[model samples]
Target: MDKANQSQQVTELTLAGLTDDPRLKGPLFVLFLLVYFITLAGNLGMVALIRSSSQLQSPMYFFLGNLSLLDACYASVVAPRTLMNLLMEKKTISLVGCAAQLFFFIGFGSTECFLLAAMAYDRYVAICNPLLYQSIMSHRVCVLLVAGSYVLGLLHSLVHTEFAFSLPFCPPAEIDDFYCEIMPVLAVSCSNTQVNRHLILGLGGLVEMVTILAVLVSYSFILSAVSKISSFKGRHKAFSTCTSHLTGVTIFHGSILALNFRPRPTDTLSTDKTFAVFYSLVVPMLNPLIYSFRNREVKSALREFVVWK
Candidate 1:
Protein backbone atom coordinates (compact mmCIF):
# COMPACT_ATOMS: atom_id res chain seq x y z
CA MET A 1 0.00 0.00 0.00
CA ASP A 2 1.10 3.61 -0.66
CA LYS A 3 1.99 5.95 2.19
CA ALA A 4 -1.28 7.92 1.88
CA ASN A 5 -3.39 4.75 1.92
CA GLN A 6 -1.41 3.28 4.77
CA SER A 7 -1.87 6.46 6.83
CA GLN A 8 -5.63 6.32 6.28
CA GLN A 9 -6.02 2.92 8.00
CA VAL A 10 -7.74 2.66 11.35
CA THR A 11 -5.88 4.46 14.12
CA GLU A 12 -8.05 3.06 16.92
CA LEU A 13 -7.91 -0.67 17.43
CA THR A 14 -10.57 -2.78 19.12
CA LEU A 15 -9.59 -5.31 21.73
CA ALA A 16 -11.22 -8.71 21.90
CA GLY A 17 -11.00 -9.16 25.62
CA LEU A 18 -10.98 -12.41 27.57
CA THR A 19 -14.52 -13.33 26.61
CA ASP A 20 -17.18 -12.54 24.01
CA ASP A 21 -20.11 -13.95 25.93
CA PRO A 22 -21.92 -10.97 27.39
CA ARG A 23 -23.18 -13.07 30.25
CA LEU A 24 -19.63 -13.67 31.40
CA LYS A 25 -18.76 -10.01 31.65
CA GLY A 26 -20.41 -9.30 34.98
CA PRO A 27 -18.90 -12.30 36.72
CA LEU A 28 -15.50 -11.73 35.15
CA PHE A 29 -15.54 -8.08 36.13
CA VAL A 30 -16.27 -8.92 39.75
CA LEU A 31 -13.58 -11.58 39.76
CA PHE A 32 -10.95 -9.32 38.24
CA LEU A 33 -12.00 -6.40 40.44
CA LEU A 34 -11.47 -8.51 43.52
CA VAL A 35 -8.10 -9.63 42.22
CA TYR A 36 -7.06 -6.06 41.43
CA PHE A 37 -8.07 -4.90 44.87
CA ILE A 38 -6.09 -7.64 46.54
CA THR A 39 -3.07 -6.89 44.35
CA LEU A 40 -3.11 -3.23 45.33
CA ALA A 41 -3.59 -3.87 49.03
CA GLY A 42 -1.07 -6.68 49.23
CA ASN A 43 1.72 -4.98 47.26
CA LEU A 44 1.23 -1.61 48.88
CA GLY A 45 1.04 -3.15 52.32
CA MET A 46 4.25 -5.09 51.77
CA VAL A 47 6.10 -1.98 50.68
CA ALA A 48 4.83 -0.06 53.70
CA LEU A 49 5.78 -2.84 56.09
CA ILE A 50 9.26 -3.08 54.65
CA ARG A 51 9.78 0.64 54.82
CA SER A 52 8.52 1.12 58.35
CA SER A 53 10.09 -1.91 60.02
CA SER A 54 13.72 -1.29 60.77
CA GLN A 55 14.17 -4.95 61.63
CA LEU A 56 13.43 -5.83 58.02
CA GLN A 57 16.22 -3.65 56.65
CA SER A 58 18.38 -6.02 54.64
CA PRO A 59 19.34 -6.73 51.06
CA MET A 60 16.62 -9.35 50.74
CA TYR A 61 13.74 -7.23 51.95
CA PHE A 62 15.10 -4.26 50.02
CA PHE A 63 14.65 -6.25 46.84
CA LEU A 64 11.32 -7.60 48.05
CA GLY A 65 10.06 -4.08 48.56
CA ASN A 66 11.02 -3.13 45.06
CA LEU A 67 9.43 -6.30 43.76
CA SER A 68 6.19 -5.31 45.43
CA LEU A 69 6.37 -1.89 43.84
CA LEU A 70 6.98 -3.43 40.45
CA ASP A 71 4.15 -5.90 40.90
CA ALA A 72 1.76 -3.08 41.64
CA CYS A 73 3.03 -1.17 38.62
CA TYR A 74 2.87 -4.13 36.26
CA ALA A 75 -0.62 -5.00 37.41
CA SER A 76 -1.79 -1.41 37.05
CA VAL A 77 -0.65 -1.33 33.45
CA VAL A 78 -3.23 -3.92 32.36
CA ALA A 79 -5.77 -4.63 35.10
CA PRO A 80 -7.66 -1.33 35.13
CA ARG A 81 -8.11 -1.29 31.43
CA THR A 82 -9.11 -4.91 31.54
CA LEU A 83 -11.67 -4.18 34.20
CA MET A 84 -13.09 -1.33 32.12
CA ASN A 85 -13.17 -3.48 29.03
CA LEU A 86 -15.20 -6.10 30.83
CA LEU A 87 -17.85 -3.47 31.53
CA MET A 88 -17.78 -1.38 28.38
CA GLU A 89 -19.79 -2.15 25.29
CA LYS A 90 -16.89 -1.35 23.05
CA LYS A 91 -13.34 -2.21 24.04
CA THR A 92 -11.19 0.17 22.05
CA ILE A 93 -7.74 1.67 22.48
CA SER A 94 -6.15 4.24 20.18
CA LEU A 95 -2.87 3.44 18.48
CA VAL A 96 -0.92 5.81 20.72
CA GLY A 97 -2.51 4.43 23.87
CA CYS A 98 -1.83 0.91 22.72
CA ALA A 99 1.81 1.76 22.09
CA ALA A 100 2.15 3.27 25.57
CA GLN A 101 0.61 0.16 27.13
CA LEU A 102 2.95 -2.14 25.25
CA PHE A 103 5.94 -0.03 26.29
CA PHE A 104 5.22 0.00 30.02
CA PHE A 105 4.10 -3.62 30.09
CA ILE A 106 7.28 -4.84 28.43
CA GLY A 107 9.45 -2.44 30.42
CA PHE A 108 8.15 -3.50 33.83
CA GLY A 109 8.06 -7.15 32.83
CA SER A 110 11.73 -7.08 31.74
CA THR A 111 12.73 -5.18 34.87
CA GLU A 112 11.15 -7.86 37.03
CA CYS A 113 13.11 -10.54 35.16
CA PHE A 114 16.44 -8.86 35.90
CA LEU A 115 15.42 -8.05 39.47
CA LEU A 116 14.64 -11.70 40.09
CA ALA A 117 18.07 -12.65 38.80
CA ALA A 118 19.66 -10.04 41.02
CA MET A 119 17.73 -11.36 43.98
CA ALA A 120 18.95 -14.83 43.13
CA TYR A 121 22.54 -13.63 43.09
CA ASP A 122 21.99 -11.95 46.44
CA ARG A 123 20.72 -15.22 47.85
CA TYR A 124 23.70 -17.07 46.43
CA VAL A 125 26.14 -14.71 48.12
CA ALA A 126 24.30 -14.88 51.41
CA ILE A 127 24.11 -18.65 51.37
CA CYS A 128 27.37 -19.58 49.69
CA ASN A 129 29.75 -16.92 50.98
CA PRO A 130 28.33 -15.62 54.22
CA LEU A 131 31.50 -13.91 55.29
CA LEU A 132 31.74 -11.80 52.15
CA TYR A 133 28.01 -11.29 51.65
CA GLN A 134 28.02 -7.91 53.31
CA SER A 135 30.93 -6.61 51.26
CA ILE A 136 29.76 -8.10 47.98
CA MET A 137 26.10 -7.08 48.15
CA SER A 138 26.72 -3.72 49.69
CA HIS A 139 24.13 -0.92 49.56
CA ARG A 140 25.83 0.62 46.56
CA VAL A 141 25.90 -2.69 44.75
CA CYS A 142 22.23 -3.30 45.44
CA VAL A 143 21.31 0.15 44.21
CA LEU A 144 23.30 -0.33 41.05
CA LEU A 145 21.70 -3.71 40.38
CA VAL A 146 18.22 -2.29 40.82
CA ALA A 147 19.02 0.73 38.66
CA GLY A 148 20.53 -1.43 35.96
CA SER A 149 17.39 -3.57 35.82
CA TYR A 150 15.25 -0.50 35.18
CA VAL A 151 17.64 0.88 32.57
CA LEU A 152 17.72 -2.39 30.67
CA GLY A 153 13.96 -2.68 30.90
CA LEU A 154 13.54 0.81 29.50
CA LEU A 155 15.81 0.08 26.58
CA HIS A 156 14.13 -3.23 25.85
CA SER A 157 10.71 -1.61 25.87
CA LEU A 158 11.86 1.26 23.68
CA VAL A 159 13.18 -1.05 20.98
CA HIS A 160 10.22 -3.42 20.90
CA THR A 161 7.62 -0.67 21.09
CA GLU A 162 9.28 1.34 18.31
CA PHE A 163 9.59 -1.68 16.08
CA ALA A 164 6.09 -2.96 16.69
CA PHE A 165 4.37 0.39 16.29
CA SER A 166 6.36 1.44 13.26
CA LEU A 167 4.52 -1.12 11.12
CA PRO A 168 1.35 -0.12 9.33
CA PHE A 169 -1.75 -1.48 11.03
CA CYS A 170 -4.34 -2.73 8.56
CA PRO A 171 -8.09 -2.16 8.65
CA PRO A 172 -10.16 -4.39 10.93
CA ALA A 173 -7.40 -3.72 13.47
CA GLU A 174 -8.78 -5.93 16.15
CA ILE A 175 -6.27 -7.36 18.62
CA ASP A 176 -7.01 -10.92 19.62
CA ASP A 177 -5.82 -10.64 23.19
CA PHE A 178 -7.04 -8.67 26.17
CA TYR A 179 -4.12 -6.23 26.04
CA CYS A 180 -1.84 -4.70 23.46
CA GLU A 181 0.83 -7.35 23.61
CA ILE A 182 3.62 -7.43 21.02
CA MET A 183 2.50 -10.59 19.28
CA PRO A 184 -1.15 -9.62 19.05
CA VAL A 185 -0.28 -6.15 17.77
CA LEU A 186 2.05 -7.59 15.20
CA ALA A 187 -0.58 -10.05 14.04
CA VAL A 188 -2.80 -7.11 13.06
CA SER A 189 -0.16 -5.26 11.08
CA CYS A 190 -0.34 -4.71 7.27
CA SER A 191 3.44 -4.55 7.01
CA ASN A 192 5.56 -7.67 7.08
CA THR A 193 6.20 -8.74 10.69
CA GLN A 194 8.92 -11.32 10.19
CA VAL A 195 11.50 -8.93 11.64
CA ASN A 196 9.29 -8.06 14.58
CA ARG A 197 8.60 -11.71 15.24
CA HIS A 198 12.31 -12.50 15.15
CA LEU A 199 13.09 -9.58 17.43
CA ILE A 200 10.46 -10.69 19.91
CA LEU A 201 11.62 -14.26 19.77
CA GLY A 202 15.34 -13.48 19.78
CA LEU A 203 15.47 -10.64 22.30
CA GLY A 204 12.68 -11.93 24.52
CA GLY A 205 14.05 -15.43 24.46
CA LEU A 206 17.57 -14.20 25.23
CA VAL A 207 16.46 -12.19 28.26
CA GLU A 208 14.34 -14.98 29.65
CA MET A 209 17.01 -17.63 29.11
CA VAL A 210 19.84 -15.62 30.65
CA THR A 211 17.84 -14.62 33.73
CA ILE A 212 16.49 -18.11 34.23
CA LEU A 213 19.96 -19.61 33.85
CA ALA A 214 21.24 -17.25 36.51
CA VAL A 215 18.51 -18.32 38.90
CA LEU A 216 19.11 -22.00 38.20
CA VAL A 217 22.88 -21.70 38.67
CA SER A 218 22.48 -19.71 41.85
CA TYR A 219 20.08 -22.24 43.31
CA SER A 220 22.29 -25.14 42.30
CA PHE A 221 25.12 -23.61 44.27
CA ILE A 222 22.75 -22.85 47.11
CA LEU A 223 21.64 -26.48 47.23
CA SER A 224 25.22 -27.62 47.28
CA ALA A 225 26.02 -25.22 50.11
CA VAL A 226 22.97 -26.30 52.08
CA SER A 227 23.79 -29.98 51.66
CA LYS A 228 27.17 -29.41 53.28
CA ILE A 229 25.43 -28.52 56.54
CA SER A 230 25.39 -31.97 58.16
CA SER A 231 22.69 -31.27 60.71
CA PHE A 232 19.08 -31.56 59.56
CA LYS A 233 18.09 -28.42 61.42
CA GLY A 234 20.91 -26.43 59.84
CA ARG A 235 20.01 -27.64 56.35
CA HIS A 236 16.36 -26.84 56.88
CA LYS A 237 17.17 -23.37 58.09
CA ALA A 238 19.28 -22.70 55.04
CA PHE A 239 16.60 -23.93 52.67
CA SER A 240 13.96 -21.83 54.39
CA THR A 241 15.77 -18.65 53.42
CA CYS A 242 15.19 -19.27 49.73
CA THR A 243 11.73 -20.87 49.76
CA SER A 244 9.74 -17.66 49.30
CA HIS A 245 11.93 -16.42 46.50
CA LEU A 246 11.87 -19.80 44.84
CA THR A 247 8.11 -19.87 44.94
CA GLY A 248 7.86 -16.40 43.44
CA VAL A 249 10.37 -17.30 40.77
CA THR A 250 8.51 -20.46 39.87
CA ILE A 251 5.17 -18.74 39.42
CA PHE A 252 6.56 -15.75 37.52
CA HIS A 253 8.82 -17.68 35.20
CA GLY A 254 6.39 -20.52 34.70
CA SER A 255 3.73 -18.15 33.43
CA ILE A 256 6.17 -16.25 31.22
CA LEU A 257 7.61 -19.43 29.72
CA ALA A 258 4.16 -20.72 28.99
CA LEU A 259 3.31 -17.49 27.21
CA ASN A 260 6.47 -16.76 25.23
CA PHE A 261 8.58 -19.88 25.00
CA ARG A 262 5.82 -22.11 23.72
CA PRO A 263 5.01 -22.54 20.03
CA ARG A 264 2.35 -20.09 18.97
CA PRO A 265 -0.22 -21.91 16.86
CA THR A 266 -3.18 -19.73 15.80
CA ASP A 267 -5.54 -22.01 17.69
CA THR A 268 -3.79 -21.25 20.98
CA LEU A 269 -4.82 -17.61 21.36
CA SER A 270 -7.21 -18.51 24.16
CA THR A 271 -4.51 -20.45 25.90
CA ASP A 272 -2.18 -17.52 25.42
CA LYS A 273 -4.75 -15.17 26.91
CA THR A 274 -5.11 -17.43 29.91
CA PHE A 275 -1.37 -17.39 30.49
CA ALA A 276 -1.31 -13.65 30.01
CA VAL A 277 -3.92 -13.27 32.74
CA PHE A 278 -1.77 -15.35 35.05
CA TYR A 279 1.42 -13.45 34.20
CA SER A 280 -0.06 -9.95 34.17
CA LEU A 281 -2.65 -10.11 36.95
CA VAL A 282 -2.60 -13.21 39.12
CA VAL A 283 1.15 -13.32 39.57
CA PRO A 284 1.32 -9.80 40.97
CA MET A 285 -1.42 -10.56 43.45
CA LEU A 286 0.39 -13.71 44.51
CA ASN A 287 3.90 -12.25 44.99
CA PRO A 288 3.17 -10.26 48.14
CA LEU A 289 1.42 -13.20 49.68
CA ILE A 290 4.23 -15.54 48.73
CA TYR A 291 6.93 -13.35 50.24
CA SER A 292 5.11 -12.14 53.36
CA PHE A 293 3.32 -15.33 54.32
CA ARG A 294 6.24 -17.63 53.66
CA ASN A 295 9.02 -15.62 55.23
CA ARG A 296 9.37 -15.81 59.05
CA GLU A 297 11.29 -12.56 59.15
CA VAL A 298 8.58 -10.65 57.28
CA LYS A 299 5.90 -12.13 59.54
CA SER A 300 7.84 -11.28 62.66
CA ALA A 301 8.39 -7.74 61.43
CA LEU A 302 4.68 -7.35 60.80
CA ARG A 303 3.83 -8.69 64.24
CA GLU A 304 6.36 -6.45 65.92
CA PHE A 305 5.10 -3.41 64.07
CA VAL A 306 1.55 -4.20 65.03
CA VAL A 307 2.48 -4.75 68.68
CA TRP A 308 4.47 -1.53 68.78
CA LYS A 309 1.64 0.44 67.25
Candidate 2:
Protein backbone atom coordinates (compact mmCIF):
# COMPACT_ATOMS: atom_id res chain seq x y z
CA MET A 1 0.00 0.00 0.00
CA ASP A 2 0.99 3.62 -0.53
CA LYS A 3 1.98 5.91 2.32
CA ALA A 4 -1.44 7.60 2.47
CA ASN A 5 -3.28 4.29 2.47
CA GLN A 6 -0.98 2.82 5.05
CA SER A 7 -1.44 5.81 7.36
CA GLN A 8 -5.20 5.44 7.16
CA GLN A 9 -5.09 1.73 7.87
CA VAL A 10 -2.34 1.66 10.51
CA THR A 11 -3.78 1.24 13.98
CA GLU A 12 -0.59 0.38 15.81
CA LEU A 13 3.18 0.94 15.78
CA THR A 14 5.89 -1.41 16.84
CA LEU A 15 8.02 -0.12 19.72
CA ALA A 16 11.79 -0.50 19.57
CA GLY A 17 12.36 -0.91 23.25
CA LEU A 18 15.51 -0.27 25.31
CA THR A 19 17.66 -3.10 23.96
CA ASP A 20 17.47 -6.10 21.70
CA ASP A 21 20.16 -8.09 23.50
CA PRO A 22 18.48 -11.28 24.51
CA ARG A 23 20.94 -11.75 27.33
CA LEU A 24 19.96 -8.41 28.93
CA LYS A 25 16.15 -8.83 28.72
CA GLY A 26 15.67 -10.90 31.89
CA PRO A 27 18.03 -8.75 33.92
CA LEU A 28 16.50 -5.50 32.65
CA PHE A 29 12.99 -6.74 33.42
CA VAL A 30 13.94 -7.71 36.96
CA LEU A 31 15.75 -4.42 37.53
CA PHE A 32 12.88 -2.29 36.27
CA LEU A 33 10.24 -4.39 37.98
CA LEU A 34 12.00 -3.68 41.25
CA VAL A 35 12.25 -0.01 40.33
CA TYR A 36 8.55 0.29 39.55
CA PHE A 37 7.41 -1.38 42.78
CA ILE A 38 9.75 0.72 44.89
CA THR A 39 8.51 3.86 43.17
CA LEU A 40 4.91 2.95 43.90
CA ALA A 41 5.64 2.07 47.50
CA GLY A 42 7.71 5.13 48.21
CA ASN A 43 5.53 7.68 46.50
CA LEU A 44 2.26 6.25 47.72
CA GLY A 45 3.64 5.84 51.21
CA MET A 46 4.69 9.49 51.26
CA VAL A 47 1.24 10.54 50.13
CA ALA A 48 -0.43 8.50 52.84
CA LEU A 49 1.96 9.68 55.49
CA ILE A 50 1.41 13.30 54.60
CA ARG A 51 -2.32 12.87 54.57
CA SER A 52 -2.60 10.97 57.83
CA SER A 53 -0.09 12.88 59.91
CA SER A 54 -1.18 15.93 61.86
CA GLN A 55 2.40 17.12 62.22
CA LEU A 56 2.64 17.68 58.45
CA GLN A 57 -0.17 20.23 58.49
CA SER A 58 1.56 22.81 56.36
CA PRO A 59 1.75 23.98 52.77
CA MET A 60 5.10 22.30 52.18
CA TYR A 61 3.86 18.86 53.16
CA PHE A 62 0.67 19.39 51.18
CA PHE A 63 2.70 20.16 48.10
CA LEU A 64 4.99 17.22 48.86
CA GLY A 65 2.01 14.88 48.94
CA ASN A 66 0.84 16.16 45.60
CA LEU A 67 4.35 15.82 44.21
CA SER A 68 4.46 12.22 45.41
CA LEU A 69 1.11 11.55 43.76
CA LEU A 70 2.38 13.02 40.50
CA ASP A 71 5.54 10.94 40.68
CA ALA A 72 3.51 7.78 41.12
CA CYS A 73 1.32 8.60 38.14
CA TYR A 74 4.28 9.73 36.09
CA ALA A 75 6.14 6.49 36.69
CA SER A 76 3.01 4.43 36.13
CA VAL A 77 2.43 5.92 32.69
CA VAL A 78 5.62 4.32 31.30
CA ALA A 79 6.77 1.52 33.59
CA PRO A 80 4.15 -1.19 32.99
CA ARG A 81 4.41 -1.07 29.23
CA THR A 82 8.19 -1.01 29.42
CA LEU A 83 8.17 -4.12 31.61
CA MET A 84 5.72 -5.87 29.30
CA ASN A 85 7.74 -4.97 26.20
CA LEU A 86 10.85 -6.31 27.82
CA LEU A 87 9.42 -9.79 27.56
CA MET A 88 7.64 -9.48 24.24
CA GLU A 89 9.51 -10.41 21.06
CA LYS A 90 7.40 -8.01 19.00
CA LYS A 91 6.47 -5.05 21.13
CA THR A 92 3.52 -3.17 19.68
CA ILE A 93 0.98 -0.60 20.83
CA SER A 94 -2.05 0.79 19.07
CA LEU A 95 -1.92 4.31 17.67
CA VAL A 96 -4.71 5.37 20.00
CA GLY A 97 -2.98 3.70 22.93
CA CYS A 98 0.23 5.49 22.04
CA ALA A 99 -1.59 8.80 22.04
CA ALA A 100 -3.13 8.01 25.42
CA GLN A 101 0.25 7.12 26.87
CA LEU A 102 1.88 10.28 25.56
CA PHE A 103 -1.02 12.35 26.79
CA PHE A 104 -0.76 11.11 30.40
CA PHE A 105 3.03 11.04 30.33
CA ILE A 106 3.33 14.62 29.17
CA GLY A 107 0.45 15.60 31.39
CA PHE A 108 2.27 14.35 34.49
CA GLY A 109 5.56 15.82 33.29
CA SER A 110 4.25 19.29 32.55
CA THR A 111 2.22 19.29 35.75
CA GLU A 112 5.39 18.35 37.60
CA CYS A 113 7.30 21.31 36.15
CA PHE A 114 4.70 23.79 37.31
CA LEU A 115 4.21 21.95 40.58
CA LEU A 116 7.93 22.20 41.27
CA ALA A 117 7.71 25.94 40.72
CA ALA A 118 4.79 26.12 43.08
CA MET A 119 6.82 24.14 45.57
CA ALA A 120 9.71 26.57 45.25
CA TYR A 121 7.32 29.43 45.77
CA ASP A 122 5.95 27.63 48.82
CA ARG A 123 9.43 27.37 50.29
CA TYR A 124 10.03 31.03 49.55
CA VAL A 125 6.95 31.98 51.46
CA ALA A 126 7.88 29.72 54.34
CA ILE A 127 11.45 31.01 54.57
CA CYS A 128 11.29 34.58 53.36
CA ASN A 129 7.89 35.50 54.81
CA PRO A 130 7.31 33.11 57.68
CA LEU A 131 4.98 35.49 59.51
CA LEU A 132 2.45 35.37 56.65
CA TYR A 133 3.26 31.90 55.32
CA GLN A 134 0.16 30.28 56.73
CA SER A 135 -2.21 32.90 55.38
CA ILE A 136 -0.36 33.22 52.08
CA MET A 137 -0.08 29.51 51.40
CA SER A 138 -3.46 28.49 52.76
CA HIS A 139 -5.12 25.16 51.96
CA ARG A 140 -7.56 26.77 49.56
CA VAL A 141 -4.72 28.55 47.75
CA CYS A 142 -2.64 25.35 47.50
CA VAL A 143 -5.61 23.45 46.13
CA LEU A 144 -6.10 26.17 43.53
CA LEU A 145 -2.43 25.95 42.56
CA VAL A 146 -2.56 22.19 42.14
CA ALA A 147 -5.81 22.34 40.20
CA GLY A 148 -4.34 25.02 37.94
CA SER A 149 -1.28 22.86 37.33
CA TYR A 150 -3.47 19.93 36.22
CA VAL A 151 -5.55 22.12 33.93
CA LEU A 152 -2.52 23.64 32.28
CA GLY A 153 -0.78 20.28 31.99
CA LEU A 154 -3.79 18.56 30.41
CA LEU A 155 -4.29 21.40 27.91
CA HIS A 156 -0.66 21.37 26.87
CA SER A 157 -0.68 17.60 26.47
CA LEU A 158 -3.89 17.79 24.43
CA VAL A 159 -2.37 20.18 21.91
CA HIS A 160 0.81 18.14 21.57
CA THR A 161 -1.05 14.82 21.21
CA GLU A 162 -3.46 16.27 18.66
CA PHE A 163 -0.70 17.70 16.53
CA ALA A 164 1.42 14.55 16.83
CA PHE A 165 -0.95 11.91 15.45
CA SER A 166 -2.31 14.31 12.81
CA LEU A 167 0.74 13.62 10.69
CA PRO A 168 0.53 10.78 8.19
CA PHE A 169 3.38 8.64 9.47
CA CYS A 170 5.64 7.00 6.87
CA PRO A 171 5.86 3.28 6.14
CA PRO A 172 7.07 0.78 8.72
CA ALA A 173 5.66 3.52 11.05
CA GLU A 174 7.48 2.02 14.02
CA ILE A 175 8.45 4.29 16.94
CA ASP A 176 12.13 4.00 17.80
CA ASP A 177 11.69 4.91 21.45
CA PHE A 178 10.01 3.01 24.25
CA TYR A 179 7.29 5.62 24.72
CA CYS A 180 5.29 7.98 22.48
CA GLU A 181 7.05 11.25 23.20
CA ILE A 182 6.82 13.89 20.47
CA MET A 183 10.32 13.65 18.98
CA PRO A 184 10.37 9.89 18.61
CA VAL A 185 6.97 9.71 16.93
CA LEU A 186 7.92 12.61 14.67
CA ALA A 187 10.93 10.70 13.39
CA VAL A 188 8.61 8.24 11.60
CA SER A 189 6.44 10.82 9.83
CA CYS A 190 5.96 10.97 6.07
CA SER A 191 4.91 14.63 6.14
CA ASN A 192 7.00 17.72 6.86
CA THR A 193 7.69 17.41 10.56
CA GLN A 194 9.66 20.63 10.89
CA VAL A 195 6.67 22.61 12.14
CA ASN A 196 5.67 19.99 14.71
CA ARG A 197 9.25 19.67 15.84
CA HIS A 198 9.52 23.41 16.33
CA LEU A 199 6.19 23.53 18.09
CA ILE A 200 7.12 20.83 20.59
CA LEU A 201 10.52 22.37 21.24
CA GLY A 202 9.13 25.88 21.48
CA LEU A 203 6.34 24.93 23.87
CA GLY A 204 8.57 22.68 25.97
CA GLY A 205 11.29 25.31 26.13
CA LEU A 206 8.79 27.98 27.06
CA VAL A 207 7.38 25.94 29.95
CA GLU A 208 10.80 24.91 31.22
CA MET A 209 12.12 28.47 31.02
CA VAL A 210 9.18 29.91 32.92
CA THR A 211 9.29 27.26 35.67
CA ILE A 212 13.07 27.38 35.99
CA LEU A 213 12.93 31.13 36.28
CA ALA A 214 10.28 30.90 39.00
CA VAL A 215 12.40 28.40 40.92
CA LEU A 216 15.54 30.51 40.54
CA VAL A 217 13.86 33.76 41.51
CA SER A 218 12.25 32.11 44.52
CA TYR A 219 15.60 30.73 45.65
CA SER A 220 17.34 34.06 45.11
CA PHE A 221 14.89 35.70 47.48
CA ILE A 222 15.27 32.82 49.91
CA LEU A 223 19.05 33.27 49.87
CA SER A 224 18.70 36.96 50.56
CA ALA A 225 16.37 36.23 53.48
CA VAL A 226 18.68 33.61 54.89
CA SER A 227 21.68 35.95 54.83
CA LYS A 228 20.09 38.25 57.42
CA ILE A 229 20.04 35.50 60.06
CA SER A 230 22.68 36.28 62.77
CA SER A 231 23.00 32.85 64.36
CA PHE A 232 24.69 29.92 62.69
CA LYS A 233 21.92 27.65 63.89
CA GLY A 234 19.28 29.93 62.37
CA ARG A 235 21.08 30.06 59.03
CA HIS A 236 21.60 26.31 59.11
CA LYS A 237 17.94 25.62 59.87
CA ALA A 238 16.80 27.89 57.05
CA PHE A 239 19.13 26.16 54.60
CA SER A 240 18.17 22.71 55.80
CA THR A 241 14.52 23.24 54.90
CA CYS A 242 15.47 23.92 51.31
CA THR A 243 18.03 21.15 50.76
CA SER A 244 15.60 18.39 49.76
CA HIS A 245 13.55 20.58 47.45
CA LEU A 246 16.67 22.05 45.89
CA THR A 247 18.16 18.62 45.41
CA GLY A 248 14.97 17.41 43.72
CA VAL A 249 14.78 20.50 41.55
CA THR A 250 18.38 20.13 40.49
CA ILE A 251 18.07 16.47 39.58
CA PHE A 252 14.73 16.76 37.77
CA HIS A 253 15.52 19.93 35.85
CA GLY A 254 19.17 19.10 35.17
CA SER A 255 18.36 15.81 33.46
CA ILE A 256 15.41 17.25 31.51
CA LEU A 257 17.20 20.40 30.39
CA ALA A 258 20.29 18.48 29.34
CA LEU A 259 18.31 15.98 27.31
CA ASN A 260 15.95 18.55 25.82
CA PHE A 261 18.65 21.02 24.87
CA ARG A 262 21.19 18.50 23.68
CA PRO A 263 23.05 19.84 20.59
CA ARG A 264 21.83 16.97 18.48
CA PRO A 265 20.57 13.45 18.73
CA THR A 266 23.44 11.08 19.36
CA ASP A 267 24.44 8.23 17.03
CA THR A 268 23.48 5.63 19.66
CA LEU A 269 19.97 4.62 20.81
CA SER A 270 21.15 4.16 24.39
CA THR A 271 21.58 7.86 25.13
CA ASP A 272 17.96 8.77 24.46
CA LYS A 273 16.64 5.59 26.05
CA THR A 274 18.83 6.14 29.08
CA PHE A 275 17.50 9.65 29.59
CA ALA A 276 13.94 8.42 29.21
CA VAL A 277 14.43 5.71 31.80
CA PHE A 278 16.25 7.93 34.28
CA TYR A 279 13.56 10.61 34.36
CA SER A 280 10.65 8.21 34.31
CA LEU A 281 11.83 5.30 36.42
CA VAL A 282 14.74 6.35 38.59
CA VAL A 283 13.59 9.85 39.56
CA PRO A 284 10.30 8.69 41.02
CA MET A 285 12.00 6.02 43.12
CA LEU A 286 14.63 8.46 44.33
CA ASN A 287 12.29 11.31 45.31
CA PRO A 288 10.81 9.63 48.40
CA LEU A 289 14.29 8.81 49.63
CA ILE A 290 15.43 12.36 48.97
CA TYR A 291 12.58 13.72 51.05
CA SER A 292 12.76 11.06 53.75
CA PHE A 293 16.47 11.25 54.42
CA ARG A 294 16.92 14.99 53.92
CA ASN A 295 13.89 16.41 55.69
CA ARG A 296 13.75 16.16 59.49
CA GLU A 297 9.97 16.40 59.68
CA VAL A 298 9.48 13.47 57.32
CA LYS A 299 11.94 11.36 59.27
CA SER A 300 10.25 12.23 62.54
CA ALA A 301 6.85 11.44 61.07
CA LEU A 302 8.13 8.08 59.82
CA ARG A 303 9.49 7.29 63.26
CA GLU A 304 6.25 8.29 64.98
CA PHE A 305 4.23 6.17 62.60
CA VAL A 306 6.53 3.23 63.23
CA VAL A 307 6.25 3.68 67.01
CA TRP A 308 2.46 4.05 66.84
CA LYS A 309 2.21 0.85 64.78
- TM per candidate comes to 0.96, 0.97
Inter-residue clash pairs, candidate 2 = none
Top model number, lDDT: 1
Cα lDDT, model 2, residue 146: 94
RMSD for each of the candidates: 1.5, 1.2
Off by over 4 Å in 1: 2-7, 265-267
Give the per-residue Cα lDDT of candidate 1 at 34. Answer: 99
lDDT of 1 by residue, 160-236 (tens): 99999888877778999999999889988877899988999899989999999999999999999999999999999
Which pairs of residues have clashing backbones in candidate 1? none
In model 1, the Cα lDDT at residue 196 comes to 89
Alpha carbon lDDT at 97, candidate 2:
95
**Residue 177 lDDT in candidate 1:** 90
